[model samples]
Target: MLIDPHLLAVFTVTTIVALVTPGPDMLFVLGCGVRGGARAGLLATVGVITGDALYIAAAAGGLAVLLTAFPVVFTALRIVGGAYLIYLGVQMIRNRKKGQTDDPAAGGMSGRRAFLNGMVSSMANPQTFTFMVAFLPQFIDPAAGPIWLQFLVLGAILIVLEFVADGTVGVLAGRIGGWLRARQAVRRRIDAATGSVFIALGIRLAAER
Candidate 1:
């Protein structure tokens, strides 16, 4: 992934915006970190990166054709993904607890489990894939380089940004898990807020063509 100045600026700006936005992915990672630990959260971050890389490849490839060819399939995927996000949000709302002691079981989520959870959550959200398909082409310059190569470069930038942001949140969550547990009301509010974001993002995604 060659990072030219222009591309770097665009990539950096987009990444910054995306990283700051709290979404299903962010909430999941934060929750996992608080529940499991930094190691688990890091593993989950890797899983999500894997999913992002896969989508990048898929978008660079001809998979967009499949989506474009079958609009209904894309719609179905959006509906399913949206529903899953809502379900996850509801779970967060229900699970928020205040003034709880640190339970080792809760923090013992295996790295493999974290990785799988991250990958599955990312894969289930068809909007990510669709967004890749839609957004990538605009930045691509076939005369500048191979389309696939350009895409890989762009995707790598996104992943690096994602890792830095999500990883930071995970580490921070690990450090503050105890404190957060003591503040049940705050946890509840965070959960509720994150849930609302997920529902809103899902709705926006579903409304997209």
Candidate 2:
């Protein structure tokens, strides 16, 4: 086995526990869902997964070691990412005011944009890179197989689990958002709330050491 079965099981359980907790990635998906709808939410999740795949590759290649060694780089990345998120939140609020929801072309959140947003958001999160570097290696066994292959296998398992957990949250949030969108007043409120979530997340990320 590329990974010890017992270790794999333990990793799976630990990952599931982590996923169930409301974290930055999950909250970001939830915001996208509430802002855009189910399809947008799903696209965002895919984007996040794609970004995660790249991070895994980086970790396997030892790029994560370089990143971790440079505390300034990590801090700079977090600040930039947080600022971008704040920008997104502000834009969302502006779009709400402009009634962009009624017109797809008027700065409405499109699927491609959602996907890109998710990808960017995921990549911007330094914590994800750090987590991959710190966590994934715990289960790896150099004696079992090629180290890179082991990383891929473990990464695949994590992505699948993330998709299931985060995807469900996105879809459910989208449904609720869709329903609320039927009422104009409620729709505006939903937009505001969603924007707030992004802003809050941004602040939290920026402030985190």
Best-matching candidate per lDDT: 2
**Model 2 lDDT, residue 190, Cα:** 71
Tell me how far the alpha carbon of residue 179 in candidate 1 is from the true structure, in angstroms, after superposition.
Answer: 6.0
Prediction 1 global C-alpha lDDT: 0.69
In the order shown, the candidates' Cα RMSDs to the true structure are 4.2, 1.9
Window of ten residues with lowest summed lDDT in model 1: 98-107
Q: Which stretches of candidate 1 lie over 4 Å from their true place?
A: 1-4, 74-103, 106-108, 178-209
TM-score of candidate 1 to 2 decimals: 0.72
Candidate 2: deviation at residue 146, Å? 1.2
Evaluated at residue 92, the lDDT of candidate 2 is 76
The lDDT values for all models are 0.69, 0.83
Stretches of candidate 2 off by over 4 Å are 100-108
Writing each residue's lDDT as its tens digit, candidate 1 over 112-147 gives 976876776675566567658887777777778788
